[model samples]
Target: MTCARIPTKYGDFQLCYYTNTLDKKEHLAFYMGDVSEADDVLVRIHSECFTGDVLGSRRCDCGEQLDRSLQMIANQGAGVLVYLRQEGRGIGLLQKLRAYNLQDQGHDTVDANLLLGHGADERSYSLAARILEDIGVKSVLLMTNNPLKISALEAEGIKVNKRVPLEAPVNSDNESYLLTKVQRMDHLLQFAPPSKPIKQRAL
Candidate 1:
């Protein structure tokens, strides 16, 4: 892993890059403080969301979650945020946009991905675990809504001390998308009712 200083509005972080033999993609880990040989380190395994993270699109709450995670870690004075390069849950950008078009036509996020011949979520946490190991993290207080992340990391021998829920406000634009995650994909998310009922199709 090669690391360099990344100064952000929240705080100063060391952005480390890693390349795995499993794929050609370069994954990143933005971290603060001394987590080396630390236990119960605060950590977030975030999948890449081009539309949501970069474009700040309201179609999903990924950008908000990413910002919140950074701020939370900054407040705590220590943590690791692993940014996986798994676009649209590993379907890549082109197909993700195709899925988005399907979603616009009323299909929920999961069904749209399935319609495009991809699993609802194709992300793997094996690389995340390896990154943590490389950083010498003994255990983690994982910040995430996806239980699959917890399970996948644990399965790879990364001890998870606890699961910290990362919740984002629901808006009409992304209510159905978030709801589909909670109801269909078993994500642990809590939200107040959207200000108004969305007319999106049922999951």
Candidate 2:
């Protein structure tokens, strides 16, 4: 693992890179403060969402959640954000875009992925656990609404002291996507009426 100092709007962080042997992809962890001996350290295992995070797509709440996690961490004074390169829940960007097309044709998020011949979520948390272990994080206050994530990390032997819900306001474009997560994917998120205009442009 290699690390370098990174300055961001939230605060200064050390960006650590981990090279994956199985898939040969690189993952990153952005963190502030030492968590070597800390229990219940704030940690967010965030999967990469190119469309949402980079493009600001409103079709999913990923980007907003990422921002919220960082802000919360900054406020709390210590945290780690593990950025996994698992675009589209591990199906990669191309298939995710294909899934989006299926979604536009009247499919929910999970169904769209299934129709594309991929699991609803192909992401695994063992890599995240490895990253956390490498950085000496023992237990975490995991920032997520996905129970699967918490369980996956626990299965990988990373102790989760608590679940910190990461919620974002619904917009017209992402309402159905968020609903799909709650209903089909068993994500612990509440749905509300769209509170703002959809900022997503067609991909």
Candidate 3:
């Protein structure tokens, strides 16, 4: 459970960087604040998104979620953000871009992934759980909108004390994508009632 210190431009953080021998790929756990002392720590298990997180692409809410989690933790003055290096839902950047192309052709996010021969959600949370245990966080208030993340963490014995929903502003371009998440992915999005049907005038 011991971790090594890692120096970064953002700030120096204690990290347990290693490859899951099961997957045999690189992953990281970033420790912040007095995680061992706090009763319920703040945590964010974030997936890597190059286009949306770094490039400000509006295709998805990944970057905004990352920013929001950082601000919330900064305000709380405690927490950890486990930045899992699973780019493009673990299929990597090139495939994600190809999925984007499929999206442009009218495929929803899930469909795009399927079209590109990838699972709808290739990300996992086992590493996050291991990292949390290593850092001595007994329980946490997880910052996320995805219920699956909450479930995954809890399933792995990372006590999730609460679920903090990260709701981003919906725009025309990403509306369908969000809707697909709600309907297909079991995301906890509150759907507004349908508006009354418009009265049509005879032509």
Backbone collision count in every prediction? 0, 0, 0
TM-score rank order: 1, 2, 3
Q: Model 2: number of clashes?
A: 0
Q: Name the lDDT value of residue 99 in candidate 3.
A: 89
lDDT of each: 0.91, 0.89, 0.78
- Candidate order, lDDT descending: 1, 2, 3
Candidate 2 lDDT, tens digit per residue, 93-130?
99999999999999999999999899999998888999
lDDT (10s digit) by residue, model 3, range 88-130: 8788999999988998888888889998889999988888788
The best candidate by TM-score is: 1
Residues 1-203, candidate 1: write the lDDT tens digits. 68999999998999999989999999999999989999989999999999999999999989999999999899999999999999999999999999999999989999999999999889898999999999999999999998988999999999999999888877878888887887788888764334435454332
Q: After best superposition, candidate 3 residue 40: deviation in angstroms?
A: 1.3
Of candidate 2, the 10-residue stretch with the lowest lDDT total is 194-203
Off by over 4 Å in 2: 192-203
**How many pairs of residues collide in model 3?**
0
Q: Worst lDDT window (10 residues) for model 1? A: 194-203
